[model samples]
Target: MLTANAAAALLDTEAEAADIRTYLATQERKTLLRFLTCGSVDDGKSTLIGRLLYDTKLIFEDQLSVLEQDSKKHGTTGGDIDLALLVDGLEAERQQGITIDVAYRFFSTPKRKFIVADTPGHEQYTRNMATGASTADLAVVLVDARQGVLEQTRRHSIIASLLGIRHIVLAVNKIDLVDFDQQAFERIIADYESFVSDLDFSSVVAIPISARHGDNVTSVSERTPWYAGPSLIGHLENVEIGAEDRARPFRFPVQYVNRPNLDFRGFAGTITSGSIAVGSEVMVAKSGRRTRVKRIVTYDGDLASASEGQAVTLLLEDEVEVSRGEMLVTPESRPNVADQFAANVVWFDEHPLLPGRMYLLRTETEEVSATVTHLKHRVNINNFAHEAAKSLDLNEVGVCNLSLQAPIVFDSFKENRSTGSFILIDRVTNATVGAGMILHPLRRAANIHWQAMDVTKASRAALKHQKPAVLWFTGLSGSGKSTIANLLEKKLHAAGRHTYILDGDNVRHGLNRDLGFTEEDRVENIRRVAEVARLMVDAGLIVLVSFISPFQAERRMARDLMGDGEFIEVFVDTPFEECARRDPKGLYARALKGELKNFTGVDSPYEIPENPDLHLRTLGRSLENMADELESWLRERGYC
Candidate 1:
């Protein structure tokens, strides 16, 4: 226990400390601008930020003293100012003289406050650049005056646009080395402006400066009399950023369910759009389930409501089936559910993206299998033209069609980040291979009645036959699979079992002839064929499909669309030697000529089925015996 005088003195100290904290919080809350400084290597990104802090006198005496001491210890010349020493203080960064990670610095000016994200300028660290730009409101893309605009410079510009940053300030650094020529600055300005004219940036400001000599940084300089713009820091303090209006669709992708104890259950995520209040009705996308918000919780405490730009936890009145991947949005402004969309893609892998291969797509918290439908065109960065192209290799930018396994709820990337952006993961290595933005959902204009008629085209003939409906066939290629399918179709016609052989080759001649043999393309071909087969099955006709449907994943996907008894798999178990001897199309010979790549049973691997509903040895057995065996199998299955 303290005496009366001692206790009173302790109370006084506590009050003073509390007063100081209140003042700081008030100052921080007044800040609204968040920007990042990014550019090529040694282009003065860190030095520029350091000069802003140092020139403003924001650095404390102790910190400045330590910087001066370190400068002398490291033997860095130039009046012991050592601006780079403040940011590039890490031992590894100092030794390598390159920024490796995103470094955040916060400081306040009299006019406005700022938070600068200094990102690495290297090409391979595009993922790191993305991480820093993920939360920035503006970006200051630096270009060395001597080097003009390099590949990484264009790449950073593209990324900034993709990340939905509103403002871009092109800082022409190291102007002193270029004699501060006004013509040089104009040339660069005109070139870059023309390049990014189509990009969706609200504002773009160009400034010429020398970060090393403090020219045009903190105040006006005599070096460039032709330049009449505000100083670097002056523009940053006055740059008009359009504030986010959260009056649009409410989107909350549940990142985590905060279950601290049995009594507490809250949904936590960073709000991407609109607002939510207590008792506000919201619907979970896809499921279309509706619920009311019980309470809006925050890190500080429970609140009456929450708005966009604020990360908070939500409590619902009912324990709905909400998960991390599912999106919570207002029903009034719900997004479209689409399985296919067009997207602008940036490919970053060594191998080119081919059609038919499967990649895992992660949009917000949701991950699904996706395939590139087709490469529309490659972007010519130098002139900004879309060249007709078939594929995109490493470090290439292009537009393409992306087909997802399931329909996803999303908005255009221009409208919302939380529901727009997604990452593509390679299925084999699980690496993030590409990044994409949804352009538009694909739409096919056809009436439901028309589709119903297409399903009934062959149903009348099948019912007239005394046999039970149709015959279903399946197997791999180069195994006399199609020949057997043709023979069986003829036999079924003669026996009066209404059947249609949807031979893979015959259908490809019309529906899928434009498709290729790439892994990505092959999957799409199968998906389209499977949909057609399901429609035929609905018409009460047996659809026989004989294609090299390699993967079990693809086969399972096809089987899911039809009823249990509607689809059947027939295995054509034939030796490679016999099939090669009877090679009808000379495809096996072409595989041996090195003319084909990714050929199953040649260069690429093939997966044989472990079990099938009907198995047949097509090569050695007589055609009559094979037909008899098929008739009995159909009889057992009630098809004949």
Candidate 2:
């Protein structure tokens, strides 16, 4: 073993000799092993990383000086330096003393290099942690010796398992604080083992260490005679990451269509699963169109072939009708074309997620409207018990049924990250609300041999007598939804335009009668209305939908279904006091009395439109004025 003087000299010599510019220019690049450092706020993860980098001679003199100054300026009671400051980059993170974003750090050893994704340990940033672990091959889960296994610990472990990361090493840090007790280490390891038993993982290793004292990191220390496992660094150096699946059915979700010029047409994206070669047979999913790869192109040059984990662009022999958000897959191992699926979701927003709410589900490159069908259950992180839940609140995890507007080709998240994972976007605000993993796709049995209906918009219009369009009106309750809808229908009738008015209360009288005023129910009601409106649009009729549509997600869903220009959102900005004075159905009175739960203008949150195509203020406007406003909007939209 090297003496203290020798170790210090070795670190100094390497730091002085290091050249970051040369390393960045010609550094060896290969298959990177991604691992996440997860633990509670006070755990010693940051210290462990700092010690590893320090011992490996990766820290230069300038960085060390800065760290030393910062350490002296903000020294804790303990003698060890505060390493958390290096990773906690944001001002809010420093003030709150917590990590928020996923910080990525790169390092290299003689045998192999690594990229570590240090994820937030807070439960609120569970989705952010998931994003990091989604691309990782292994996970380094840290825990405090005194705290043992907390709820967040189990939650992170389960998420790692669900994401298909098989290798997990539980690093119990700060063992010195617990007197390096053998019993303490064994007890924590046994409890963690029991919790991980139900999960599908390849291996689990536990190591006890004190990041501050540098015990059992690069070398085993005599202080923990009872511990017999490899050190934390040793496990990482020896961990074997098998090559990703290159033999499964090939799936490439087109993120961009590389039509650089008239002669060049290519599909480009990172390969999420399988492999492809220049002459390989590929099929465009959903469309069931097959073609052969004419050439494999890349930024470097034309490649002979591409494998899993490689990002490349491919040129097909035929100029097929493929576009961004389409999937290029192998016909033999094609994914299921599904419109409805069950997914496990981690709700992030304060507004609880409820069934029947329409939100944009982005899978691969395709974005479509998805409705929550049912809340399966909420997971209790501490004990892993699943209880039936009706709604999922902020920082809650649950399983639910999702119904998309149209068929989408995808695989189970367990099968492929590129095809199985999706995000829920609010239709109105475009805010990312939730992250979901597809569990299973629902299928419908069809035996009918009816001729394929290849009807065009013109053919469909002949039956409905008008062009298909979505007229959306959004505002607070008692903002003339019913009145404006009635007037619009009268006007359209006089103009010989086929029209259908999906007046909110009228449909609730039959279609959505079972729904209530709760936030979850309201979301579902709007989703149902949007679906009906979409069908009416497909039937080639001028469909006018007048609803409060308080949620941004519901409005976005309607827009996605109709695409751009087909769906129009009109804002009716009437003051709450004025709408209440109208007392259209005594709703405002009920809301004031607290008889209505999640009322739009009461307990529930309403997202006001920032830029609606037409803004109509009903407070001071007469009935004729409102009608005239609607008429002008229709004319501008070419409805007349």
Candidate 3:
């Protein structure tokens, strides 16, 4: 080398050139695209992503060397570099040769920067797929040329549509395996278009490509002369994902109340949609109180205005009451505020979703107790048909009526994704069991309100000599529950106690006539009957409910509806064999012959009470004796 000064100058020049190159690269990646690749297992989704990364020169030299070595050692491409190995980073995935979790990759080209989500293909991981699609602006659904359209493909398409993904690309992968047949590609395209006609998508383009051979991915392939469409990478780079959110109304859900000092108080949250200025008039959705925005506080001092995707704190001119879970929106265009709404839900729990069970409904920054009041129908992914469904199992999509404990602000999922999506969490386990998109708020919820009356339940109960109570009888079918309840009601009636008996079969003829013997229907049947009994108890009556409430959870629900010490669970304990032998109405015989489906003691399950207030061994005890025991207990409790 020459002198040390000359060498230093040369090094500085190289450094400046590198910095200039980096700045130009960053400037080139001005536009950002978030998309997801989804398809069935072995559909070459990861391979397509790998091909994009490799062909664009995004892979490092040393990483490529290691990949070449790994391909020689354990590649599935028969000694060629397995492109899937580039993205399947999990050990379990590499061992099983299947993607289990969503693998995210970031890469940029001359036109735009891309964040690609490679979602799993297994049906069990449908929740993971939903999570990935929830934030994606476009979806690239891959299909194997040999298999054409499959059930998993339809399922993913349905989910993508439900998630409001407007742009879709049907990548007919592995075209070379079929000798670059244009007819096969056309057939697949026709099948897909015909099936997807019902879905709501802005545009759907079908492109034939070979991800393994890097044909028609980043560059036009010479093999596919019939395919006039742009390559996959070219389409992704140029597709205009519209900025529709800018035109939508503003919505900001307050996540935290920021009180840095006594003088400074602000509501902090991310702007979900539209834009907000410092002097904009905002309304608290829940309270409907109007106020003016005073300041927009951020980490970089303060902002005069905040737009969608910006997280900032807002200070209001008026000291209006605000809390977490409250939403700030333009008063002129407020979202719907209601407790009852209809939503499309994807059930992800192993246990099927039954109506009337309480779950934690969590949205952006709010959580409320909610119940799936009714399941409208389940969507069949294979044919896009709606079928009657009482409950939703794992990986099933259904439209349901939800009842929330409190009103929340929301928009139709089609209008805004941030304010319209929510997840159901299991109350006991705190596990996410379902994902739902709000369709619309039910009109009845807003129209009807609980009218306050001078004559309350307490006043009605005080009018009667005894306290209002619900004596619920539960056991297997033909377990003498009805007979024992009738005798107890008569005994209480003779003792001048205001008692009314709500027998299961008698009430089924009128109130619960629409219900069937299915587990979901049974749960609803119990719910309706319990509400009626609660109303009767509020009318100052000692209600005796006799039903074969087989499920312990349902009995607990009824118990929870009553006041403390007001519900007395009477377990009519009779063995299944004993109940079947004593089937007076021939129900057990019909159920055994498969004529009566979902008949308890034959096919359906009956959960026994772990701890009942009164346990009567009906095998050895008479109905009159059991009634006397209940009457004695009531007398001791001063209810008679």
lDDT for each candidate structure = 0.77, 0.80, 0.91
lDDT of 3 by residue, 1-640 (tens): 6699999999999999999999887876578899999988889999999999999899999999999987776578997899898989888888888889999999988888899999999999999999999999999999999999998999999999999999999999999999999999999999999999999999999999999999999989998888888999999999998578669999999999999799988999999998999899999998899999999999999888989999999999999999999999999898999999999999899988999877889999989978899899999999899999878999999999999878888999999999999999886568999999999999899899988889987788777788899999998888999998989888988987888999889988999998898888888889898889989988989999999988876787788778898899999998889988999899999999999999987788888888899999987778899889999999999877
User: Taking the tens digit of each residue's C-alpha lDDT, what string does model 2 give over 322-369?
Assistant: 988888999898887788888878787777787877778887688887
For TM-score, candidate 1 versus 2, the one ahead is: 2
* Number of clashing residue pairs, candidate 2: 4
Leading candidate by lDDT: 3
Kindly give the stretch of ten consecutive residues in candidate 3 with the minimal lDDT sum: 552-561
> Per-residue error at 296 for model 3, in Å?
2.5
Show the lowest summed lDDT stretch of 10 residues, model 1. 444-453
TM-score of each candidate structure, all chains considered together? 0.72, 0.84, 0.88
Give the lDDT of residue 160 in candidate 1.
82
lDDT of 1 by residue, 361-399 (tens): 898778887878778988876666789876777767788
